[model samples]
Target: MRRDTRNRLLEAAEGEFTAHGYPRTTVTRIAASAGVSVQTLYLAWGSKRELLRGYLESALAGDAASPEDAITRFTGLSPRERLVELADLVGEIAERAATGWRLYRDASAVDPDIAADWDELQLLRHRLIARVFEDIPATALADGLTPKAAVDTAWTIASPDSHDLLVRRLGYAPGEFRDWMARTLTAAVLAPDSGADTTM
Candidate 1:
């Protein structure tokens, strides 16, 4: 029952935040939307900022397999295959987390509390992206591209901002965005002689 109530509050918070944005959204409104009392909401999340952070965390944790496990599965795949798999994983994450990220990004502009949360989220994402890149064989990397550079490339390409521009603003279908990511990563990260098929 507690879990269900928490989920409802989170759902309500997402709707409220999306419609009104962080600055305008209220705990009262979210509680009303969730059919709970404001006290209940506070008991669950402590503050509106925490409620928003909870919503972001829930959205990013989609129903699919955890990203860490998914990355581990990349083992033994060829370089191109790994890139393609990574692209698909990134697409899934972007689709699930984009709205929440947009909310956080916008809120962080004016809210110091949210800015700290946003910075922490960025650091976590960077660590995950670095872990993903760590699985790529060094020999497969483009000449003169250090592991750090490759991770940076992947991180930039897979960022929520990039996803918003391509998938949300530019109207690229999710699959199209994924395919583009695969092609771009292949070209940018793989050595020409790495034998990883570069055909788009």
Candidate 2:
């Protein structure tokens, strides 16, 4: 029952944060939406910042395993296949965490409390792409770009912001966006003459 209440509060908080953004969402609004008292919310999460953290954590708890496990899973794929797999994986993550990501990113500029989390999230994202880059063969990378540079490029193109621009703003369907990511990564980051093109 206690866990259920906590989940309800988190759900309400996520909805509030998504709708009004973190700066405008308040504990009272979340509490009322959750059908719980403000005190209950406070007891469960300590502060609105904590609630936001909880929401982000829950959103990121997708089907992925630990970093070690992910590395092991990617180890067997060929370089081109790894890039494709990484694009698919990153797309799924961005899709799941898009709401929280936007909320934290928007709030981080003015909210000192959210800034740290936002920075940490960005670091985590880069690290995930770095791991994928580690699996890619050195020969597969575009000329004149180091592994670090390649990883940075992959992170930028695969980001939720780009996904939102293409899918949400330009009206590309989710599958088309995913396909575009894989193709773009292949052409832009992989070896020259790889035959991958941005046709979609």
Candidate 3:
């Protein structure tokens, strides 16, 4: 089927991009890996850049419900509980999408189009983090910390860059990273009496 072929091409593109890096990855290699003709690969996605974009987008999306929808379920929980839930959600996303994000970050340095796309993705990520902060009452925020600051703190902590540093380079298990994120976010963003277990 057409959809199956497209999926295969995208998978092949991810593998090729991961194995060869975007600059060195070729359409021919991806096509060969996908068991498709070069023309078929071209038809599915016009160029290597487009193919990389498609693959990264697919990786970010995963097969679960949209992240926006997922965040809504954490509503009404206490601020600390919400942050802990958020850490879990972000950890899962980082596990799925961090590799693709790193690829995008690297490719963006050399490709104007990828740079633009990467900026857009970061903006979307910021907006999502802001939405999570919106649910936390202002009173619960650390003294002198504005809502914007709280969102920024969460955004930076939840970034793929952080995930890469802790998990890929430093060898943190995913759960350890998630727990660290929860504690760090709670300590940084919540007031002293905001019910955060900040002992660690």
Candidate 4:
């Protein structure tokens, strides 16, 4: 019951934040939408900032699961198979993030509170990705680019937005997209190794 209430509040808050953005959403509105009292919201999240933070954190969760899971999920996947899985994952994650991204992207100007939390979230996300890259075999084999550059490039290639734009929008099947991305990103991580395009 406690968890259910919390989830309801979060759902309401997410809808409110997405609809009105962080600057405009009020606690009373949020509570009402959740079918709870303002006091219940306060008890659950303490403040508008906390609620926003919680919403943002939840949105980011899909993208922040352990790196190993991501790798394992793609393990049996040929680069193409992984790419398809990644595309589906991208679609799934983006659907969840749609509203939060809007609020975070647009609310930075009107709300200092939103801006602060948004900035922190971006930093936290990047750090988690940086941590993941620290263990990548590709990073070691990659040449020409600095280690940081290679890691950043690899991560960017694997990002949801890139997948959406490249695979989903471009009309390539998810598998083809994932395979191409893996090969391209692999090249970016390691040296060309000569005649590699022929291998494809």
Winning candidate number (TM-score): 3
Alpha-carbon local distance difference test for all models = 0.85, 0.81, 0.86, 0.64
Residue 46 shift from truth in candidate 4, angstroms: 1.1
TM per candidate: 0.92, 0.89, 0.93, 0.67
Candidate 3 on 89-173: residue-level lDDT in tens? Answer: 8898888888799999999999999999999999999998888777677889999999999999889888888899999999999
Residues 1-200, candidate 1: write the lDDT tens digits. 39999899999999999999999998999999999999999898889999889888877877645646655756667778877888988898888888899999999998999999899888888788787677677888999999999988887887888889998899999999999999998899989777755322
The number of the candidate with the highest lDDT is: 3
Report lDDT (Cα) of residue 87, candidate 4. Answer: 42
lDDT of 3 at 13: 89
Alpha-carbon shift of residue 54 in model 4 (angstroms) = 1.2
Whichever of 2 and 3 has more lDDT, that candidate is 3
lDDT of 3: 0.86
Q: Which stretches of candidate 4 lie over 4 Å from their true place?
A: 62-92, 138-142, 155-188, 194-200
What lDDT does candidate 3 reach at residue 181? Answer: 95
lDDT for predicted candidate 1 compared with the true structure: 0.85
> Which residue runs does candidate 1 get wrong by more than 4 Å?
64-67, 197-200
Candidate 2 residues 74-118, lDDT tens each? Answer: 666776777788877767766778788778778889888689888
